[model samples]
Target: MMMRSKKIKLLSLAILSIGLSQNALAEDHWKLFLKNAYIDRDFDNDAVKDTGSWSQAISLFYDSKFQDTPIDQLQIGLDANVQYAVRLSNDKHAADSVLPFDAQSQKQASDYAKFGGAVKLKYKENVLKVGEIWSDSPVANIDASRQLVGTYLGGTLSSTVNDHLSLELGVLSKYSARNDDQFRKLSYTQNGNKIQSDGMSYIDLKYRVNDQLKAAYSFAHLENIFNKHYVGLEHNYALNADTQLNSKVRYFNVQDTGSIAAIDSQNIGVIETVKYKNHTVAAGVQKIVGDAFPALDGYIPELYFVNWNVTGFFKKNEQTYHFIYGYNFKDYVPGLNALVKYSYGEKIKLADGIENNESELNLIGAYNFQHDYLKGMGLQYLFAKYDTKYGNDFDENRFFVTYTKKF
Candidate 1:
């Protein structure tokens, strides 16, 4: 695995360097940002303890565009970024009580630092990108704390075949908790043994129909590990100049690859025999609300789905629902925004009577400062409440302050 990972990295770097050298050289742009955040959590069940934690991050980024070069139809660019973090407060025992044994030691720990960088190459309608990049799909997203940077090590090729179609392909390593410089894949330990996926590859396609509709499909294979497929459709309709309607629907299916078994009796007994499956649907509406409001972030309708795990997650099956809404005050408050969201999910029991239902609600508000001397300054707060029918109920709050500048 190490040998293969090294080869992929070397090959990607070569391609990026070659492509960038062939394009015109342009001016360089740089930016820097700093953020601080605090979190407090309280659980209704005394079994779980309350906890408080704080974190801070600093990031620097550089971008360069090529304008004049020998390649007439080619465009080239490069990006590099670095980020660092540290924990300011500690709640060791509080986190240990509720977090899983593995995660408790790593993710919930009080302090840690990580950094990574990436480089890319582009030519007209086609581009090849390499290094640590952030990628998101309906099934998975690389989430960064609003203050930090998130990334993955991989190479991706994206191109537009014509005006109406686009395509993408990529190979990637397992995701990292922090954007570290380590090029090797990490292992998950169980009973003192290490486990790792072989590799992951994916292909994506997009098609546009006139001005109101678009569709997308993606298929991914986690070599000898698992397979995932997704299909989605989006439509937009104008309702005069002040109102509009937007809709989106997506479906995902996942299963274990041939080299991997859906059931492993040596690890778990009867529970291993079950396979997982799931389906999800979502929609939303937006109203301009006059020139005073100007912008509407829209809302997600109430919807639910059932999911079965042929590969990941602990439980074999589950059901879930999500509803959310957001609005931006472009004219009223300039740079202020508010949002609310709720999600509920539960484990599905077959012949056995096991009950596990979890629900959560979130509220957020943010304001940005627009002054020249203190531009890119932001203040934000978030509140969340979580309830589990057969487990615990918890509440959490977070506050953030950020400042950013670019040159």
Candidate 2:
């Protein structure tokens, strides 16, 4: 613990110094962000640990671009950021949390800092970045649903092949997800061998079929760990100026490579939404094939249309369904919206031939201030309940407030 603390202090000091120098160099423009998050949770009698946390984070960023004289079409840029977070007083008892700490989350649950710098180059429609950077594609995304933003150390490239097609490529080596402090090699944590240089390479392509239809595919190879392929299709149909219909379908196939072939899984899902005036209604369903939808992810968001609030219905042979209703109060009260969702999953296979069922209900209300000084401010409240036949039951409440301003 002492050695880790010292490392954090050293990194923090170095980053602070570099950030101060950068702020001086970019006197006219620099970015600052402050964020705070709190989670309040109640568990069933069987749960013995606390499930609450409070975290506060701050970050400073500087980015600049210049065109080289010799290469008129080439542009070079530098991007740097320093970020730090501290556990708030409200979460002092989180040391005994319901879930055991992962290496990254353990470090982030205290006062810790991270520094990142990236060099970017652009030629025509192609852009490349090397070193520390951030990317949030659907299949591979940084975990930013918490106090701190997720970051990666490696290289990535994006290019527009033509008017109808685009491509993305990445070779990421290390990253620190939202709750983690120290960056670790990007890999699946559930592996028996805890630490492996699990470098990942991926390529994604998007093609536009027309003004209302689009399709995309992404492929990833996690060195000796796993392989994943995802394909998605989306279409929009206009019923009228005030009414429309949208549909999306996504499919995922994953398999383990190397010595471990346990992560094999497949998921197929579709979602449809109808909008009329200020009201929107949506419904979706997902089917798990092969084994369970294995959680082979760095930071897994519900890429599927049916996965909602609590769990993603990622159990063996499970099927999930969800419905969401949203109302936009913009017609009467601008910048106000509310959503209610219900999700259910069943048909989960157990080792002893039993079946498990799970469900969740979520209520959310959000408001964005539009006044002069508070124009960028926002407030939100969310209440959720999760029930399961096989695992612990829980309820959660969250409140969020945010504001951004440029100097």
Task: Identify the leading candidate in terms of lDDT.
Answer: 2
List CA RMSD, all candidates. 12.0, 3.5
lDDT of 2: 0.75
lDDT of 2 by residue, 51-89 (tens): 666666667776765446478899887777777766664
Task: Please tell me which predicted candidate would have the highest TM-score against the true structure.
Answer: 2
- For each candidate in the order shown, give its overall lDDT on alpha carbons: 0.55, 0.75
lDDT assessment of candidate 1: 0.55
If scored against the real structure, what TM-score would every candidate get?
0.72, 0.88
lDDT of 1 by residue, 240-309 (tens): 6555566666555555555423422110101001111111123222111111110001110101112111
